[model samples]
Target: MLVVLVHLLFYSCVLSKVYKLQLTHKAKHIHQHKHHKRQNSASLINAQDFDFYVNVTVGNGQVFSLIVDTGSSDMFVRGPGCVSNSGDNSCECDNMLPNPTACVLNTFDSSLSNLSQTAYVQYGSANVNFNIFSGPVLFDGFQITNFPFGSAYQISGLGNSGDGILGLGFNSISRVAWATGKDASIFDALGLTGRQQIFGTYLSNFDFQHFVNDVVGGEITIGGIDNTKFTGPITYVPLISESYWKFNISTLTFSFGGSQPLYLGSSGGGNAISDTGTGQIYLDNSLADRVNSFLGGVYSNVYGSYVVDCKWQNSKIPMIFTLYGVKYSLSSSSYIIPYNGVCLSGISRNGADGHTAFSNFGQVWGRSYYTIYDKFNGRIGFAKAV
Candidate 1:
């Protein structure tokens, strides 16, 4: 009996030691994961996704659409369908053209090709095709030199989602640069010597009305922020990580009146991905219905636009996107665009598998947040305001 008792005591001691070690190891892993996640969230925003809209004139006094994007510098348009300045020969755009309204080059330069049917370019997803070309860039009453540009595959609905997309993100985040060998972007051409190249852009009031007209051009000042257009003080956030360009978010809390502030994705390693190319905010689908319920379903999504009841009124829901030990609120107006004073613009879902740009994806933050891609300033800032 004495021998058995001693043996039992030894085994118990050993088991306790093993359990302690296991607990210590798990704690360390949890700490490491949280630290790494925070770093990723901060770096993601540093990636640039800015683009500008423009108007181009074709034959018979017809004006078409164009956009300035650094991601894709090369510009191309449909050779057969679109109107041109004056020639009927095989479509071509050259520097020496008399009118200078040259179409983007359609030649298959091996150096610039990415995919066989489509040119592989980077935007929302990895390893995809982007249509690139060159055309005249007109901004703020100034006709800058004709530069390279590009577009994306068109979705059938969405009320004519413009002719194409103009990428303005930095080369680090651009797919256009990888597809085409042309490294120099419009920002580089407009460089001001010592300062980082800058472009200033302003959207015309008409664009909000959804009509095709000459772009009353905006300023795209590279290397600096356009103080005239943005009135509020800029909030600067650093890009600390790489590859994904994500940063560490301390917390993301949302509140509605007296209810306890709901912590979003605190568990399961949840972090918000900011994308300008995406026109809405995307969250985990599981959280979509919960968030929408909190917002009172402000906009009924139809054809990708919000149709709200003009007399609808609900408690102002506040979403605080916290990063790098700081917090910024998603303004009420930004989250909910009122058709008049009561009706909301819309709320849509966003995701790759079953989500969309309309879901709590791009428009969530894109509509309200004044995203400052100060690549030149070396920091990205988000501020909430009217």
Candidate 2:
């Protein structure tokens, strides 16, 4: 019995010294934001079925669509001199979305504001590359000013989602900081804003058969939860790792039609990343193979993902994740994706070596619940999404 323990030791545990920036809001103002407006709410646009994007207003009325990512902690946009990793042939973006002006590189203008220091990030596994410059980032409202962000003029393999990524994770282990040699700001700026130290992600369900780009998807609320998005009250759990919004998932079981739950054979628990950027629920190689095989799925070398029978969509099967002793369940509807005349399994292998159970509770899990990344108290909150 080769039981692999899901462990993600790739993320550094060292906490860096950050120059905290505090945005002081008055007592009455804070109360109103919490009780009245729910504070800093933005609608999410689903980029097909891949991921979600939020349109952000940047320098001098330049509206750029940025992926609302909770897994990473740096914000950058499509800027000038952008090109594909292969060459200058492709810009690695969508085919001209109507609302967002720049569907390609050469969008960001460094001359519009003060720009100094270079930042670059490379996702070796995903084949996405970015070259960035740190500068003052301006928002449309809520007045999150003087936030240091990345202006990526050179990029490749950005995919068809958005112009850039708006990372919402903690800055303690920011890759942008490692790239630019300067403090990465945004989450830090929101933390010191004297309001709620939490932000919520609500990715909506769309028409599976007729999915397309530029559709109203969901919302991202900063400061507090929108009581309307979820049902009942929220259940909060302490974060096991703050660097990447990680928590320990006790077990994963396959249950169907009120039958006895079948364990997918992951033991000693596993650390799962609650990532908005990731679209599929990732499990260890052994565990994923086990789960997919049981679900009548097969691995495709061409796609590099597991493909299950399209009939599995109506199988009434639910994959349950026991997180901190709480069972959070996802129905087949949320886990089975219909793509290009075939159904793609929302679960995939983590691409890590044996004996490690570094799993990920991707956006499919988010579809089952409204997730709150609570920074102040260092915890994650979950509520059944309505």
Candidate 3:
């Protein structure tokens, strides 16, 4: 079957300013009967921002574990004669990672699979030569054909990243489709019942209390929303554009305990995109500098991010992001990543290597909200995960 598992990384990105909620009256929860009973969903495996991937069985029963990325729209894999980048722990499968067999990955064999012609793909840090395989892609109960993908022969800067990358992005920018002059993306090839083109993501991190993955778990849900993964009403916002899962920013806020939510005021008219592939949350320099100013951190050229006192991890609550009129948030625990006895802010200034221009909400943002991709209606939903 064509299996597509989008594994979001507990990658070393996504950050927030520290906030000490006022110890006035304690926070209380009022139960309400607002539920989105969409039942189609899947599970995800996240290693504390380290990596998120899935077992995808492609053409001719070949299964590959690919990183499910929503940032760019293209797919590629490493096959015969593939090489790895030096110093990348991914290929070596470091013991510190959640998956002890992280390096025990898979690769495609172009010579074995049915093929059409040779093709080349140039993407972020990847340069590959592959064959246009003519076969079916299967997953769950869904089968996709007509659309084709590359079974790479010679690859570089890719296999080292993961088994491969399964791009869950729009077709307008698909490199394989543009090169082959055919619909090569699985997103465009799947023949779903009715016009239901919804994709949902429930991403989680390694909670120390529950070291063997959280009890709630995480995964990418296709078809419709998974009511069991989240609770309450989903905050929906119209997609401002069709290229990416892009949306407009209403306001970014934080507060001192229970004081009135203080607005960042920097992202007033700015826009942001939800990227599953990237681990860090990026914003304009003014906004990042402003957030870091409040968090009281200094930039570290060595790490290409701000280094904060680890103590700030305890004095924080969720950082609020207002889109349209709905509010979504990410807690400081997810952003204030602990490393070598110090914490690094996942929220950083854009323009760094491998970052988008506008504000980008990567896995850090998704860790807080159960993100839903309403492809048919051109909207995105953020349901606060229970």
Best by lDDT: 2
| Deviation (Å) of 53 in candidate 3 | 0.8
- Please say which candidate is ahead in lDDT: 2 or 3: 2
What lDDT tens digits, residue by residue, belong to model 3 across residues 196-260?
Answer: 56777877654644444323236766655556668889888789876778887656564433556
**Candidate 2 regions off by >4 Å?**
1-38, 87-90, 96-98, 104-115, 127-139, 178-183, 191-195, 209-214, 251-269, 352-357
Clashes of 1: 61
- The TM-scores of all predictions, comma-separated, are 0.55, 0.79, 0.74
Model 2 CA RMSD to the hidden true structure, in angstroms: 10.5
Compared with the true structure, what per-residue lDDT tens digits does model 2 show for residues 302-377?
4556778899888877877555456777888888876656676777766635344356666777878999888778
Order candidates by lDDT, high to low.
Answer: 2, 3, 1
- If both were scored by lDDT, which would come out higher, candidate 1 or candidate 3? 3
Least accurate 10 contiguous residues by lDDT in model 2:
26-35
* Root-mean-square deviation of Cα positions for candidate 1 versus the true structure, in angstroms: 21.1
Model 1 stretches with alpha carbons more than 4 Å out: 1-52, 56-63, 67-118, 121-146, 151-159, 192-221, 230-232, 240-250, 265-276, 298-320, 324-327, 337-347, 352-367, 384-386
